[model samples]
Target: MSQKSLLLTAKQGSFAVGTTPIPKPGPGQVLIKIQSAALNPVEWKIQAYGLFIEKFPSVLGSDIAGTIEAVGEGVTGFAKGDRVLNQGTRGDNNEFSGFQQYALANADVTAKIVSSLSFDQASTVPVGLATAAVGLFNQGKSNSAGLYPPWEENGSGRYAGQPIVIFGGASSVGQYVIQVAKLAGFSPIITTASLTNADYLRGLGATHVLDRKLSAEQLKAQVSSITSASIQIVYDAISEADTQVAAYDLVSSGGTLVLVLANSIPESKRTSDRKIVNVFGNVNAPDNRATGASLYKQLTRLLENGSIKPNRVEVLPNGLQGIVDGLKKLQAGVSNIKLVAHPQETA
Candidate 1:
C-alpha cells in the first residue's frame, strides 16, 4: 500500500508531496488512517534551520488525529475504525511520523476521540496537553514541577487557594496549563496575553489576563495585587528571553518555573532558590511515556465532560501538500488557532 506525504527533499530544502509505502503497525502499535495533522513551529524550524533532524527526505509532523485502520499484535482495547488521537514521531522513525496518510502509533499514548470533537480539534491536544501535563505534574525536577497530577486519586483541586501564574495564556500549551491548574485547585490563576483574548482565557480558567506586553515591573505589581500569597508555579509557554526573565522574576522562592524552550535567562539574573525546568513537549519520549500513557487514559473523559477542550483549528488546503504551505505560515507565527491539514485529502 502507498500513501501521499509531505517530504523534505534535502537539508534546508523545499517540501514536496510524494508517494511512500504505507506503514504497517508493529507489535503494540496501530496504523492510523490520518484525518487531520497539525503544523507546529518546530516543524518549520527543523526544515529552515536544519535542526532536530539529520536525515534527508524527512517527514515532519507531531499532532495527529484519525481512525484506526489496522491493529497490531497484542494491541487490545482498540479495534479497526476506532477514532483516536496521538503524538507523531520523526527523524529516527519515519513510519511513526505524521504529515502522511497513514502512520503507526504506540497504543500506549494514543487516546480515543470523544464524539464531541472532530479530528481537527483532537489533533491539537497531544502536543499541547503533553507539554502542560509533564511540566506541571511529572514528578521530576529535571523537566517538571514534580507536582501531583489532578487526574490521579485525590489530586483534583489539591492546590486550591494557592496562586499560579502562566505566561502566554492564549497559546495552545498555556490554555491547557490554565485548565490543568484549575483542576489542581490553583486559585487566582493569572496569565499574560493580548487584552483581546482576556475573555477567552478567562473562560478557560484564567482568573486574570495581564497584557503580554506588560513590563516586568508592571506585571509584578499586577500579580501582587491579585494575591499576597507567593506564586508557586509559573508556566512560560512563549519562553522567549524576555518572557523567561519576567517569569523567573515572578517565581517565589523554591517555586518552579516551566519553560517550553531552552533557558535563556542570563546567569547574572539567576537565583539559587528558584528553579527553572525546560519541558520536552513530545510525550512519546521514553522518559515521559508513562505520564503520557496516564494522560491518554484520562483524556477521553476529560474531553467528554468538558474538563479539557481542544484548540480551535484552521484547516489548510491540498491535503498532504497543504502541510507544506502551512509550515510556512507556522514559521511566520500563529495565535491561539492551530493549523491542521487532512492528509487523506491529498491528490
Candidate 2:
C-alpha cells in the first residue's frame, strides 16, 4: 500500500505533496484510511514560526475523521473499517497527522465516530471540542451555583450553575466553549465578539455577546451588569494582552481563567486568588498521555451523543494541494469557518 500527505518543506513555506510507503500500526496503534482532516490556526502558525515541529517535511493536521484499516497489537474494541475520529497530536510526529491519505492513530486517543454526523463534521471535532471540554471540566472544581451545566458526572459532582464567560465566542474554540458551557448548565454564557457574529454567538448559547472592539471600560461594564458574581470561570480563546487584562478584571478573587493560547497572561495582572491556565490542546504528547486519554474518551462520548456539535467546516475540494490555499485563508482570518481537506474524494 502507498500513501500521500501534505508536507511543510521549510519555515514560512507551502505544503508539498509527499508520498510514503503505507505504514503498519505499532503496538496499541491503528492505521486509518483518512477520509477528512480539519485545518487549524496552529497549522499556519507553526509553519511560520517553526515551533513544535522537530524537522522539515513534517506532516500537519490534528483533527481527523476516518475508517480504521488495521489495528495494531494490544488494540481491541476497534476493528478494521470502524469509523472514527482522533485527536491527531501524539500520532502527529508519526506516519499520520490527518493531512495524508492514511495515518496511524493510537488506540487510546481515537474514538468511534458518531453515526449521525458526516465525516466532515467529525473531522472538525477533535482539537477544538477536546480543548473546550478539558478547559471547562478538567482542572477546576465544578460550579454549584447553577451558573453552568456539567458535561460529566465526576464522583466529586457536576457543574451546578456557574457564571462563565467565553471571550472570542465567534472563533471555533469559543463556539465550542459556548455550547459546552450551556450543556454544562453555565448560566449566562457571556461572550465577546464582533457585532457581525453576535447573533451567531447567541444561537450557539451565549446569553450575551459584547463587542470585543468596545473600549475596556465599556466591555467591563457590560460584563459587570450581567452578573454581580465576578466571572467564576473564563475561557479566553483569543488570549491577547488587552483581553487578558480585561479577563483579570472580570473574574473575582479565586476565579479561574483558561487560555487556549500560550502565555498571554501577564504576572502583574494576576491576583493572588485568581488562577491562570494555559491549555495546550495536544494532550497526547507523551507526557500527557495518561490524562489526555481519559479526556479523549469522554469527548468521544459527547460527540457520539450530540452533547456537542462540530463547528462549521469549509471543505476544500482539491485534496492535498488545497492545503496551501487553506493555510493562506486561515492566516488571512477566515470567518465563521474551519477548513477541512478531504483526502478521500468519495468521502
- The TM-score, computed over Cα atoms with residue i paired to residue i, of candidate 2 is 0.90
Give the per-residue lDDT of model 2 (tens digit) for 120-153: 9988888887667666555433211112225435
RMSD of each: 0.9, 3.5
User: TM-score, each model?
Assistant: 0.98, 0.90
Overall lDDT per candidate, in order of appearance: 0.91, 0.77
* Winner by TM-score: 1
Worst 10 residues of 1 by lDDT: 137-146
> How would you encode candidate 1's per-residue C-alpha lDDT over 254-304 as one tens digit per residue?
898999999999999998999899999777888788888888889889999
